[model samples]
Target chain A: MFFKIIVFIIIGIAGGFIGGMGMGGGTLLIPLLILFTQTDQHLAQAVNLIAFIPMSAVALIIHIRNKLVEFRHVLITALPAVTASVLASLLSKRVEGADLSLYFGIFLMCLGVYQLVSAIIALIKKKKSQEGKQSAENKRELSENRQD
Target chain B: MKKLLKKVVVVVCSAAVGFVNGFFGGGGGMLLVPLLEKVMKCPVKKSHATAIAIILPISIASAITYIINGYFDWTSVLSVSGGCIAGGAAGALLLKKLPTGIVAVAFALIMIGVGVKLTFF
Candidate 1:
């Protein structure tokens, strides 16, 4: 029992760390729980949802303290977000467990691939711009030396 | 007209994030930040910070439904939450030091593997 508790806490810490970093820890948590701990897919999703309450609260407090949050916008987003979340929850409840996991998996894959490709492209673009600037500097230096 | 259109965009975009988060749990911030930044003209930092704030209520709404629906594993919840709070503190503290780009890449890979396993296997 003690060992199990320790394991669960460790998983939470990892998830929290990722989430706190704004990496969407809850998304990763579900699969980690299911793959490593053999937790049921639906159950992992529920636990992550519960844990997010506190985690997000802490993050929000920090953001608020830093004056990063804009309340007027928050109000606009929050109401619609809450309503849609309720509707989504209702839909999720109707989906069977296997299908739920499958859907979740598909969502992740598409998002993941998209993000990864974007990141790689961004990196390439940055490198290309740097090289271009460096070569431009080299050309300028060559012209100055030739004149001298 | 343009102002009202932007406000409407905010609601529509956030609603999409909310629905996905409500269905899955724990990932609306990604969708929220860009929408707020582009549609609402919020700065990136403000968008991220606001996304965190927006997440809390939506999470509560989703979690309540999950609880009522009887999907909880109390033991995991209690144990994990203990770690989550502590880890959140640590992550926040280390926010300046970490390279989020690397983390994002790693996260993407993990998601790919997990998604494949869940779907086909």
Candidate 2:
């Protein structure tokens, strides 16, 4: 029992770290719980949902203090978000756990591919800009030689 | 008309975000940030901060539903949440020090690897 708690904590820490970095910790957490802790999909999802509450609440307070939260925009989304989430959560209960986990796996892969492609694009852009700068410098040097 | 269209788009997208978050039990914030930045033209920092504000209430609503459905597990929740709070602080601090680009790449690879494992094995 004690050992299990330790394992759960470790998984939570990993998930929290990723989440704290704004990389979607619950995505990682749900998988870890399912794989390592033998948690079923629905339960794992439940754990991730509940775990996020306090952490987000704390972060929200800080963001509020910093005036980072836009209340007007939040209001616009929050109503729809809450309504949809409640409907979806209830719907999740009807889905089989294995099917849900399988779907989640596909979703994770898509998200990963999206992130990877975007990161590679950003890197390529950076390299291209640097190369452009170097070429411009070379052109200037060549013109200077012609002038001389 | 354009303004009305944009509002409608935001509403539909927000609904999608809520549905994803609720169905998956997380990941809504990831989608929300982009919507805010690209569609709504919110600054990156503000989008991230506001994402939490938006996700918080949605998560609370989902959590309540999950609890009512008998998905609650006290022991795991207590231990995991405790670790999450502690690790979240550490992660926030690490974010300032770490090169985010590299971290993002690594995280993406990990996600792919895990996803494959879950799907096939």
Predicted structure with the largest TM-score when compared to the true one: 2
Q: What tens-digit string does per-residue lDDT give for candidate 2 at A13-76?
A: 9999999998889989999999999999999999999999989898889999999998878988
Model 2 stretches astray by more than 4 angstroms: A125-148
TM-score of 1: 0.88
lDDT of 1 by residue, A1-148 (tens): 8888888889889988887777678877788787777787668888998988877876777778989989988888999999999999888888988898899899889878876876677677778999999999999999999999
Instruction: Provide the TM-score for each candidate, comma-separated.
Output: 0.88, 0.92
**Native contacts recovered, in order, as a fraction for each?**
0.82, 0.79
lDDT of 1 by residue, B26-113 (tens): 5687778778877888887888888888888998888899888888887899998889888877887788897666767787888788
Root-mean-square deviation of candidate 2: 2.6
- The structural similarity of chain B in model 2 to the true chain B, as TM-score, is 0.97
Candidate 2 chain A: worst-modelled 10 consecutive residues by lDDT: A115-124
What is the DockQ of the complex in model 2? 0.81
Interface RMSD score of candidate 2: 0.9
